[model samples]
Target: MASEGAEYDRTRGAGDTAEATGEGGRETAAPPDPKIAAAVAAAEAAGPQHGETVRIDSWIWSVRLVKTRSLGATACRGGHVRVNGERVKPAHSVRVGDEVRLRHEGRERVVVVKRLIRKRVGAPVAAQCYID
Candidate 1:
């Protein structure tokens, strides 16, 4: 047991890309694919193309308004989330241009939907999804 503990293996984490690339130090992020870039740009430029909607909890979580989907749902259930001047449920569908008010961390965050995104994105991208 002592020998085994002394011989413990040290493995790199998934994020240790530099070590994988011949100790190149931090690796730069490759440019995004053009097709995906175009899609994201279009999505950021416009609202939902069709009569599309996403759950309020999902939208809030996707846009980083909350740390997790469950937190967003809890806020909705606790009446801490409101849409268009009315409290809504976690499953309530949030449409583009609707105003959302979230009471979180002892302050109220009021924002309007500029774009609808169903997936969590980077802070920059998430910031584009709403109007502060």
Candidate 2:
């Protein structure tokens, strides 16, 4: 009976292992990937690593400058966006605290960067990235 039960346990699924062991198995609480863990630890040890300043063209599309990322691209195409007093293309990369000028629908606006973000964000979260 003991040998048969041991064989059954060996073939059990991950869920079964968790239930039987009273602790979530490696499938549920696995350690972070070693490479990612090392990277994170290194970054943490780096002590508030300040990023290098970048140009606005490099950040426009990536940070969702306009409505859509593609819209940011179009705005650059249409000469509606300028970085650091120079009209730039979508390829311009923006750095933290860089000044930006944007023209849409014949209206011009200015902003300063407070943060750099690559993901599309909601209205409230998006506000955190720039100063209008």
Candidate 3:
């Protein structure tokens, strides 16, 4: 009886050996296209590591420039955000010494990146991330 059950388990898992063994590996992310997946992989491999890079949207919201991260992303999508004189997407990486410009509420804010931060911080702490 045990051998029969074992055989059944093997038969069921034979098609996907990796998942069956529960190895420390990841599966495909359901990317839309092979080319797109390759591009994303290349970007990730080429980009700076986590400690060296922060997403522009997160940095903006972190430094209290925007009320929320979503708003920061919206500003980027609307072309109200610029980095180093070029409009950038929300996912663009921001580094120290980069200049950031934000247009909001009938005003434009220009600040240079001093430090990279990810979390929303209090005003005092946020101020340390950029120089106005």
Candidate 4:
């Protein structure tokens, strides 16, 4: 699962490298791109990718998980959702890779983000947008 420009985890034992996980688990020593590093630093400095907090209505709402952002917002307002392990309002901001925990109707769901947008995208697109 090798991809270009992936960072290796140096903490692993030497032979563990061959297990060869990519991206989150990549084991190869790859150099960081200066340009990318600069851009990432700038984004971080500007704020958390999507900002410290973002309104649910402004995001590509995860409908299936909790129904419309409005519903999600309602749930959030009612303290049904948590961002980074803390309960937040429906308007609490989210960004790429943000971990979300959703509780609804006695069931709990956990998801990790793979993308973020400011519009209502279709189901397939929304699915692609998350990595739960």
Tell me each candidate's TM-score: 0.66, 0.54, 0.61, 0.53
Which pairs of residues collide in candidate 1? none
lDDT at 105, model 3: 86
Ranking by TM-score: 1, 3, 2, 4
Best by lDDT: 1
Taking the tens digit of each residue's C-alpha lDDT, what string does model 2 give over 1-132?
999988887778665866867643533453345554444344335322366444454455434556666777788878889878887877786777778998876788788887665544445445556788
Query: What TM-score number comes out for model 3?
Result: 0.61
Error (Å) of candidate 1 at residue 93 is 0.6
Q: Give candidate 3 misplaced runs (Cα > 4 Å).
A: 1-51
Off by over 4 Å in 1: 1-49
Q: Write the per-residue lDDT of candidate 1 for residues 52-120, one digit (tens) a residue.
A: 888999999988999999999999999999999999999999998999999998999999998888877
Going through the candidates in the order shown, the clash numbers are 0, 10, 0, 2
**Which ten residues in a row are the worst by lDDT in model 3?**
23-32
User: Residue 54: error of model 4 in Å?
Assistant: 4.1
Candidate 4 TM-score versus the reference: 0.53
lDDT of 4 by residue, 10-125 (tens): 43444475454454242223225454444434433543343445465345264356557677778888887887899887667677777888788899878886655554544544
lDDT of 2: 0.63
